[model samples]
Target chain A: MSRVPLTRKGFDAMRVSVIHTADDIVREHIVNKSVVMFDILRASSTISTALANGCQEVIPVVEVDEALAIASRLPEDTCILGGERSAVKLPGFHLGNSPLEYTPEVVAHKTVILTTTNGTKAIRRAAGEDGVVLIGSLLNYSAVAHKLFAAEQDILLACAGTRGKFSLEDTFAAGLVVAELVQLWYSRHNAAPEESCSPQADPVPIYAEEVPVLPENGLLLEDAAVAALRLAEAYRHKPLRALYDALHGQKLAQMGLSIDLNFCAQLNLYDVVPVYREGKITCL
Target chain B: MSRVPLTRKGFDAMRVSVIHTADDIVREHIVNKSVVMFDILRASSTISTALANGCQEVIPVVEVDEALAIASRLPEDTCILGGERSAVKLPGFHLGNSPLEYTPEVVAHKTVILTTTNGTKAIRRAAGEDGVVLIGSLLNYSAVAHKLFAAEQDILLACAGTRGKFSLEDTFAAGLVVAELVQLWYSRHNAAPEESCSPQADPVPIYAEEVPVLPENGLLLEDAAVAALRLAEAYRHKPLRALYDALHGQKLAQMGLSIDLNFCAQLNLYDVVPVYREGKITCL
Candidate 1:
């Protein structure tokens, strides 16, 4: 059941909605929609990282036992266990939920089975029988949007917030995805980006009206999307700085994992757009 | 059922959380917390308007029959049965949910027993076992913030979004409340409004960093609160225009209720802060 039933009935418009946390998944219907899942503080970033580094595939599961079970079925040398509970590596797991741990030297050609406190659960929950689910992060935001641009489907920015509460970094990353999508649309229509629209430009009031849509390509921003986009506009120029300033960023910094923030914050570091379908994530 | 379990353990910190919709209330605990509920498009606005119009207590209920049953027990002349379902005045009810309908001429000296689609459920849900509940709207945002500022409690902005989805106007109004609270904090310490800080000024980046904290007056903004504040900053100068441009605003205009938008969008029109306690709402 769609929370906003009638408004979504007619248009095949790219009506984007941002679900603030994994717990909010129950309030939304994922059927026939395209979901871009973000856990930018790590999970989605890690998937983007691992996939770009030539990991064969990533299997995200909600439970540690499930990840272990999936891994046990694969050849030991061909598969790796990765993820975290309480932001620490699970006992007997091969790696924690950090993008830095998934470098090419480490995960090349290996299937990574992952479980985490929020991200994996978020990815699993955001999936549906008749929808497309793509992993997104600041690292591959434009790539993710490129894959979704021509699809006439509802888009849900599935944010894997920290423990069911809203995560600033995840939503911030989702906003980046939303902005990238809008910028792509503008470019497709032969509209040049305003001087103030550059990611490196100083912050300015980038009005939503800048998104002038053609009738056939109607893109609508739901309330959450509009809010996310505004918040994203504020920190687009200094995304890494913005991410480092998030509460989780501060905590991770304190945890001696400051390396991960720099890893996750690099824009378009990976052009690989990972798609999660049939319980596995793989990318070109 | 606190969504952020461990972090809230030690705070009397006035940590403000913005629940984007009424459905999100389930993930938060209201006990020992003060909630400022906003259904700014009309319900809470109607409450603020009615009370400001010199009405007696406003009784909010979720069901039509309960409103009717309560009104039946009161002196017929002393209670006004007012509410709406699906944005239309309920048959047999004396008034609809529009703030314009609760003029001083109609609601004066009468207890309004209200039953609305989302607003009552939000107000009741935000109330806790041992905390304060206040109805909030753009019409009385500052008054509500003033009441909460010195309370030294965790404050939740319980936004009654449409159905189980997010509402732009409600959160926008909630943002106004958040900004007002911050501005109040600034003013308390004799910090004059920055050149760009006035609500009537052009849109500018009102940095969250502007809110410096003293040891005793520490106010922390949660993720949703931060997002809300950014949204508020974008529209503080033209809130009425912003409200009128919201999806619900256009819907109301289409429904011939455009006049209500002007009424609800008026910031701090009523200095009266209505408190919801023990099943009734009243103000001095």
Candidate 2:
């Protein structure tokens, strides 16, 4: 059975464990087994867009050879090689992992066998965990949270910061997620005195204690929750799910990768929650 | 002779070090022989303020006994004991370390004996070394740079972050010092193009190769410069000079013992450089 319908406030009550390095992700049991990937940089955002545009599947590999080997196995028309070393594009590839490059015209209905410096390394390392594995970015945050709330497992929103170093954009986005999840959990778990002991205590208090609390009813409230909800509803479940739109989403949109962002931001997009199965990511 | 006049561009270039824990700092270089103290929270900021005010002298002690012991040595009407445990002012402390708390009216013309958890410990550790130590913070960044430039000796702007853990604020302040010193060094060194061995042998290229170039003049300009400069400056300085500012100045200011930002900010106001002399801090 599903654990419980975790309200928005319920999520806020929990503290996020900050996974600093690629090694930290491996060492931390909780992170290895239960976290979702959130890379706000051009990589994850672009990958989400590529998937949503009807790509066959995103097979994340670590090394260049690994990506090529996987691509060699797939039908030539069905798969394409892509990624970057630094800010520059790879020497000889069908694409670079820029969301701006993965537009509806370019990547719509193409399978991207990809690897990245950091994000893919994280994905490869977290391949076979026991819990849900979801993609998170600014584009699909609301949809991801709503789905996460419905599932109600302990969540670890892993921010794929640059090369194991802290990046402001990633942390800021994670803070937004923690803030939203708490609010949603609170909405569902806030119980009257009669319902207090019924396994539905308010999650707001828990978040207040563990996480850094922003101003009450402040920008954190509107950005993490309200704006996210609006974006998800507008996409109508097309962006967050499906390999095609997942590769292109809203973060890309504002970054001039709008086509990708539009596709990556879909709400309630996929019924099957992806999980790490047998050293590989698989959907339920 | 003093090294050289510092350029305006010097202080603008900044970098910071993220000392994650007490263990990390200790492991890097912490022994009884090592004269280094820690400043985790607002002690750096407070001390900057105290020196800015008209405080006659500031005394730093490690233990509570040391603080009281030092106070006993001072004239009763001239001295005050101050500091804090957490954010709260200590039981007998005449003041709490907060930038907002220190004002000229209360602190003017007073002598203060101060102690704190992290900053004091770090200061006490670095109490005796060959180098002169001066407090560094946002409040006195320009002044520290000017003093260090004139002294021509190695400058170590140690940050007392929280309980040995890295605090963003302290790290940021450290970066400011690094930026200033590096720029000053660059401007002075770069001005001597006529002294080159050959017309084609510009030393600028060699210098650039030796020192890491900062990021482009963009949004991350401030952050990028701060961390880079801190590391470079620390490495460039002679390693022997050990000095502690905790006994007075910033530490004193934090305890509400006394000083002002203006006083701390005054560049090279003191011709007498305070170096680590004997087992305690003294002006050379």
Candidate 3:
């Protein structure tokens, strides 16, 4: 193929790209980037709840057999096999991927052997200690944003989309995370000094375009991230509406799981960021 | 992967998805779908300009050598070898992808054998007689959207991004097309009957979520398409700013091609839609 290389690689700004699904991720794009993976509907919400509720650790495996094998190695009483295949609790599993199911009494002091169709596989595939993998969802987006801001590396929001297609809820959650990061970045680095901001600095600009410019060392949101931020802005007044906008949410609502939707849509309810490093997810 | 299928497949409505870059397109998603391939930086814009300015026919080839070979077969005086590699005019080629250069005086009534880094290849690769492929850009998006609405098939906006990564201009143009299609849909299909519009129809709803539901037989913008639409909405007041916001546009500006940028960003200056079918691009 006769083509030029993407020139953005030489750019020095802190960049963010929202990979719509795990299937769409390019390894090179995320190889050295800090990742915040979102499976907003359930898996991520479940992980956050388990961690906040005192679970010792969450082992996100890619396959059910792997989870079962890992559980088999641990003492039966010390491990809880918890996950869903096609949104149903697998045979002999204690939980069905609902955040409510990971209550303190049920998950406390136990190791969660988890696998889901999308989220767990994404977690297993994208995990690398060098990338600072963090599990994100509405329940922990602000905490995730704080980590992303402090890390100051190229960022990727890997959305564990439903069944290898773009999932609205995951993208919406990603947009929320991006919005928070932008807010945090601006708060940490205030506008130019009043003297430099004076109109006399430059009577003329390069282009008379109204688009916001990324200041030096400021974050550069890619096109996908910018789109996601717009989405987040549109749903700022009612974040839960975003969850309900997805067909996955409608399916869950039809299956009498609106309770879980309500539970997962609460932003920053738990001040926890689950860091996935060296194969285990524990609170940051 | 243990997963349920994406439930939206069985949906009874018009659906749209925006594939961010040529490399990201899934063949299955576009198998029987009508596609508007956009390389908004230049290729599509150039094609629109050529067709609008009275070119006989435009044949898109994937390689410069293929173009040269094809031009060799045609009478030299009748065929115009046109295209660019890395935004530079190829050796012996007549054009370097700037819309302004394809004046009627130069290309009128001549066959254009064109190849470019992104858009032309996407056109050659995605063209099928049955899918109703069309070359689209900011230049002809409305006309393309008109064809899309009239065709009544699943729609795709395939962005021929800068290299293998997403291009901001292409996605923004896609968002504009989506907005147009939406406006046309709403204009053609007015609200439900006045009787059905009454408040007493149902005092309760399925979920208390504030989402604009897709009316029967209406368009279902997928998550990516939805994001694109949001982007279009963000720049609705200052459409041209979207072009300058892209790194590609900045590169072009640095190379003194802002004339092409301004030419491409005008929403619908050319009242032409170039249909790519049977390996040739001609007016619809």
Per-candidate Cα lDDT values, in order, are 0.75, 0.45, 0.76
**Where in model 1 is the C-alpha error above 4 Å?**
A1-12, A129-131, A187-217, B1-12, B128-131, B186-217
Shift of residue A219 alpha carbon in model 1, Å: 1.4
Q: What's the C-alpha lDDT at position B119 in model 2?
A: 65
Cα distance off (Å), candidate 1, residue B258? 2.2
TM for candidate 3 is 0.86
DockQ of each: 0.16, 0.04, 0.18
Off by over 4 Å in 3: A1-12, A128-132, A192-215, B1-12, B128-131, B192-215
Q: Model 3 misses residue A276 by how many Å?
A: 0.9
Tens digit of lDDT per residue, candidate 3, span A110-181? 999998877888886566433447899999888888877777678888888888877878888888888887
Better of 2 and 3 by TM-score: 3
Q: Model 1, residue B143: what's the lDDT? A: 84
Residue-level lDDT for A32 in candidate 1: 56
Ranking by DockQ: 3, 1, 2
Q: Which model, 2 or 3, shows the larger lDDT?
A: 3
TM-scores for all predictions: 0.84, 0.51, 0.86
Per-residue lDDT over A165-271 for candidate 2, one digit per residue giving the tens place of the 0 to 100 score: 54434443444455456557556646222221111111222112222223223112211122122222222222222111121221233234334333333332433
Return the TM-score for candidate 1, rounded to 2 decimals: 0.84
lDDT for position B214 in model 2: 28
